[model samples]
Target chain A: EPEVTQTPSHQVTQMGQEVILRCVPISNHLYFYWYRQILGQKVEFLVSFYNNEISEKSEIFDDQFSVERPDGSNFTLKIRSTKLEDSAMYFCASSDLGYGYTFGSGTRLTVV
Target chain B: SQKIEQNSEALNIQEGKTATLTCNYTNYSPAYLQWYRQDPGRGPVFLLLIRENEKEKRKERLKVTFDTTLKQSLFHITASQPADSATYLCALVTAGANSKLTFGKGITLSVRP
Candidate 1:
């Protein structure tokens, strides 16, 4: 089965530095999403992308966060300036038809 | 505001017994509800989905029941084994064609052999 792939399974960055998390969704999927889970917390929705544009975003997706589909196969999330709270497990997910969503193994972001 | 709630506490059950988990929501109309399993340090894996119009959905030993009127969903695993132990999450998809999902904190299940 085809799966979503993400680069840099784990990352450690300075508190004020910028970080980019890359993901390659399923080739045929039209909708893509990013979600994060803090330690011992619920999975929170960040943003959804479709047609190379943001379709929906939650309140937690503030000015520091941006998503881009720079190419046909690559979808990336950029954080302009990282905060300690930004440290979490970020998951990229995709769905071809809306039946079910498949998630990548996730990128663990650690900001010190 | 929309809110999703799960047991938060871990559930312990014996092998070959049935385990039932509950999920409740408030202040949102969800078109569908989904269940997922997550192991330690891994992303969630989809298990089952139950639509708002449907009362129950089943896959092998797993069963899910949705009650839109009560704003709750129940997940049941029958004849469960130690392999079935994991954190289970319930997600709610709002009313739209391609809306985003909101997830609960999840409940951990421990099956003892």
Candidate 2:
């Protein structure tokens, strides 16, 4: 089965630094999404991308955060001025039309 | 406020028995609901999805029932095995075509051999 791939399985960064999480979605998928799960918390939606633009985003996706489909297959989430609270497991997902999403293993972002 | 609730308590069941999980939602009209399995330190893997109009759906030994009136969905794994031990997350797709999934804090199921 094809799977979404996320790079940097684990990353540690200093607070106030800029960090970018990278993901490569499935080739045929049309929709891509970014979600984060804080320890012991529910997975929260961050943003959804389609047709090379953001279609939807949650309140947690603020000015400090941005997502881009830099290439045909690569989707990225960049956080500027990371805070301690930014530490979480970030997952990238993709899906066709309205089907169930295929999620990546996730990137564990730890801000010190 | 939109909320998806799954039992926070861990469920322990003997092998070969049926394991049932519940998911309930409030304050949101979802086009479809989905279930995903996640192991420790990993992301969720899609298991099944049931639309609002569909009452029930099944795949292999797994079954899912959706009751839009009740605003709930039930996931069941039959003849469970130790390999079935994992956290199951229930999520709702809120947007129309390009759906945005909102997930619940998953419920852990421990199937002992």
Candidate 3:
């Protein structure tokens, strides 16, 4: 089965630093998303991207966060500045027809 | 405020038994509900999806029941094995087609051999 791929399985960055998390969704998928889960917390939706534009974003997705589909295959999430509370597991997902989403293994971001 | 609640306590069951997990939602009109499995330090893997209109859906030993009136969904794993141990998350997708999935905190299931 084809799977979504995310690089940098784990990252540790200092506070106030910028970070870019990269993901390669399935080749045929049209919709992509970024979600985060803080330790011992529920998975929170960040943003959804379709047609090279953001379609939906949650309140938690503030000015500090942005997503880009810079190339035909690569979808990236950039955090302008990291805060200590930003430590969490970030998951990238893609959907072809929009019913089910295939999620990558996730990138663990730890801010100190 | 919309909230998705799963069984808060972890479920422990002996092998060969059937395991049933509960998911309840409040203050949200869900068009579709999905179940996912997550291992330690891994992303959620889709297991099954139940539409609002559909009452029950099955895939092999796994079965899901959706009750819109009750605002609850029950997920069942029959003849369970130790490999079935994992955290199960129930997610809600609203009426909007492109809406994001709002996930529950997830309940852990442990199947002992």
Candidate 4:
């Protein structure tokens, strides 16, 4: 089965530093998404991308965060200034219409 | 505000028994509900999906029931084993099919040998 791939399985960064997380979504899937799961908390939707642009975003996705489909297969999320609260597991997912999403293993971001 | 609730924080069951997980939602009408499983330190893996028009759906030993009127969904795994032990999350989809989901905190299941 095809899989979504996320890079830097684990990352540790100092607070106030910039960080970029990358994901390569399934080739044929049209929709891509970024979600965050804070330790001991529910998974939260950060943003959804379709047609190479952001289709929707949640309040948690503020000015400090942005997403890009930088290429045919790469989708990336960038956090301009990481804060301690920004630490979480970031997941990337993709899906075809009316189908279940295929999620990547996720990248663990730890902001110190 | 939309809220999805999986009441039990954790559950323990013996092997070869059925494990049933409950999910309830409020302040929203979903077109379909989905269930996913997550192991420690991993992202959720899709398991099953039941639409509002459908009351019940099943796959192998797994079964799911959606009660639109009751605003709830139940997930069941029959003849479960230790490998089935994990955190299960229930999510609600409000818009078109395969859209962003609002997920519950999830319930952890521990199957004893």
Candidate 5:
């Protein structure tokens, strides 16, 4: 079965630095989403992208966050300034016609 | 405000037995509910979805029951094996095309062989 794939399974970055997490959703899927899980916390939604534009975002997806579908196959989340609280597991997901969504293994972001 | 709650602790069960997990919510009515499984350091994998109108749904050894009246959903795994051990999450989708979800802090299941 085709699955979503993400790059840089784990990343360590300095506080105040910019970082970008990349994902390649299923080829034929139309909708894409980003979610994050803080250690010992519930997974939280960050943003949803469709037609190369943001459909919805949560309060956690504030000024520092941005998502881009720079190419047909790549969906990237960029954080302008990383903070200690920004450390978490970031997941990418995709869906076809409102059916179940498939998620990538996730990228663990660590800020120090 | 809306809140979703799952048992914060892990559940231990013997192999070949049934494991039942509970998810409860407050202050919101969902159009649909969904369940997912996640292994350590992995993303959640979709397991099943049950709409508010439907009382129950089942797939293979997994079963889910939605009680909109009680604002709860029960997830059951029968004839479970050690491989069935993982954290299971329940998510709710509000009314709208955008359909953003609110998820409970998952319940971890540990099945001993």
Candidate 6:
């Protein structure tokens, strides 16, 4: 089965530093998503991307966050300034029909 | 204020038993409901999906039932094994089929052999 790939399985950064998480979604899938799960908390949707632009975003996704499908293949999420509360397991997902989604292993972002 | 809640935080059962998980939603109507499995330190993996109009759906030992009127969904795993231990999440599509998914806190199931 095809899989969505996320890089830097674990990352540690200073609180004020910038971080970029990368994802390579399934080739045939058109919709991509970014979600985060804080420790002991439920997974939360951050943003959804389709047609090379953001389709929707949650309140958690503020001006400090942005997503891009720069190469039509690599989907990336950038946090302008990382905060301590930003630490979480970030997941990347893709859907072909938008009903069932395939999620990546996730990248553990630890903001110190 | 859409809210989705799983039955509990954790459950443990003996091997070969059936594990039934419950998911309840409020303050919203969903087009479809989905269940996923997640191991420790991993992202959720899609397991099954049941539409609002469908009563029941099955795949092998796994079965899912959707009750739109009750605003709930049930997930079942029969003849469970130790490998079935994982956190299961329930999510719903708040709008059309193409909408984003809002997930519950998830329930952790432990099948002891």
Q: Please provide TM-scores, in order, for all candidate models, with all chains considered together.
A: 0.97, 0.97, 0.98, 0.98, 0.97, 0.98
Kindly report which residue stretches of model 3 are placed more than 4 angstroms away from their true locations once superposed: none
- Score each candidate by Cα lDDT: 0.92, 0.93, 0.94, 0.93, 0.92, 0.94
Q: Provide all candidates' interface root-mean-square deviations.
A: 1.1, 0.8, 1.2, 1.4, 1.2, 1.3
Kindly list the per-residue Cα lDDT of model 4 for residues A2-88, writing each as its tens digit: 999999999999999999999999999999999999999999999999998888899999999999987788999999999999999
Q: Chain A TM-score of model 4 versus the true structure?
A: 0.98
Between candidates 2 and 5, which one is better according to TM-score? 2
Candidate 5: tens digits of C-alpha lDDT, residues A16-35: 99999999999999999999
lDDT of 3 by residue, B1-113 (tens): 87899977599999999999999999999989999999989999999998889999999999999999999999999999999999999999998747689999999999999
Q: State the DockQ of every prediction.
A: 0.76, 0.85, 0.78, 0.74, 0.76, 0.79
Off by over 4 Å in 2: B95-97
Looking at model 5 chain B, report the run of 10 residues with the lowest lDDT sum. Answer: B94-103
Candidate 5 residue spans exceeding 4 A from truth = none
- Candidate 5 RMSD computed on C-alpha atoms after optimal superposition onto the true structure: 1.1
Clash list (residue pairs), candidate 3: none
Say which docking band candidate 2 falls in.
high
Q: Candidate 4 has which clashing residue pairs, if any?
A: none
Q: When superposed on Cα atoms, how far off is each prediction in RMSD? A: 1.2, 1.0, 0.9, 1.1, 1.1, 1.0
User: What is candidate 2's lDDT per residue for B3-93, written digit by digit as tens?
Assistant: 8999665899999999999999999898899999999999999999998899999999999999989999999999999999999999998
When candidate 3 is compared with the true two-chain complex, its DockQ is: 0.78
Question: Model 4: per-residue lDDT, tens digit, B1-113?
Answer: 76888989999999999999999988888988899999999999999988889999999999999998889999999999999999999988887534898899999999999
Candidate 1 residues lying further than 4 Å off, grouped into runs, are none
Residue A50 in model 2: shift from native, Å? 0.5
